[model samples]
Target: MTTHANKKTALVTGANKGIGKAIAAGLARDGFTVFLGARDSEKGHAAAAELKAEGDVRFVLLDVTDSASVQSAREAIESETDRLDVLVNNAGIASAPGSRFKEPAEEIAASMRIVYETNVFAVVAVTNAFMPLLLRSDAGRIVNVTSKRGSIGEEGAWVGRPNMTYSSSKTALNAITAHYARSLSATNIKVNGAAPGHVATDFNGFRGTRTPDKGAEVAIRLAQLGKDGPTGVVFEDDQQLAW
Candidate 1:
């Protein structure tokens, strides 16, 4: 029955490892009570324990792909605090490289469904479910972890990039971010998309040049934005990119 009434609170999905865990750790270090949400209880608790020395950190079971799980997590948070200052949608999945382009049509569709289920649909579900709590905060923020490859404005650069499923899902996520930001413009909440660039994680088979800690930087920055910060934009590090 620990209370987080005096501090800002944040929830980072898929926070058991990788970028999600890094973001949770960063938020905790910034004096926010961070809920490390992970589908697996063991991993989630382990991550929370590892970050215990950093600051206030807790573990919450959250499966972004499941509506029931999402609601339960929301209720769990509500039971602890009336407001959610930050919500980081960091849970995502990608088909093995080249699978989208080399697989059969049916296989490609199935893969797309899997990616969209977590990347796009789950983001909408989680954000919508937590909107009430976000609105209650003094400086609410929503950070959708997206990718530069999802930008249609840069389509020419992706000529041979084998990321049809993953890329398109992020594109949809960016759209969701814009839609939410517009819808909540009159309110105090700020919603934006964050591109972490290519980070070395299990999602990309550890081939990326940067580390998960580096990827979490943008999302952490977005999460800590003040009331005056810009909204409805896609940012990479500190630079705003075309949406």
Candidate 2:
């Protein structure tokens, strides 16, 4: 395969479309060999083909909620490359009917399990599984795609928000980032969380104000962070977010 002295390898989960797809495209353009991970093979292959036409991009089958799928994806990567330079945990789900903040605990708990299964639980699983590959690199990066709604320090509490499932899931993800960063502090890897703000993506019915390209900006920046860059922090646009 084509290679370069400074070439990096990055994996972006849920990249079949929207903000995740944008981040994968941006990273590929930056000279990184990008693996576009998707749950659907058809959509994943199409996305990978589209980006491969522009640069070095490949398809990777990944289902955040499935342990077997995650293991297989990691094995495939190990077979192709010796190191993982970046890992973007962008896979998430928002369960309906009870996904709102005002939903009852019974409904909220159900939605919470689904949301956290993909957003929080999967993040930890993926990170722990790929960490060995990431450690193989000189400078490894991890960017957890979180949300502004997750900031407990500023948002007060998750109870009032109508978007409880999605919001609370992100809050748990932010905690995961901090915990992972602290655990890897002495190493070269830097882990951080990023909120895309209000991005116009299909997940939100494209109602957000910012474009998907704009939403992926900070995530890309955090992924390309140098050895001295900050870790265990939350960011959106260029500003550091609370909690």
Taking the tens digit of each residue's C-alpha lDDT, what string does model 2 give over 38-113?
A: 9999999999998876579999999988999999999998888889999999888666443444454545455567
Please tell me which predicted candidate would have the highest TM-score against the true structure.
1
Determine the backbone clash count of candidate 2. Answer: 4
Model 2 TM-score, all chains together: 0.93
Spell out the clash pairs found in candidate 2: 100-162, 101-161, 101-162, 101-163
Clashes of each: 0, 4
* Superposition error at 195 for model 2 (Å): 0.7
Against the reference, the lDDT scores of all candidates come to: 0.88, 0.87
User: What is the alpha-carbon lDDT of model 2 when measured against the actual structure?
Assistant: 0.87
Give the poorly placed runs of model 1, Cα more than 4 Å off. 96-107, 155-160
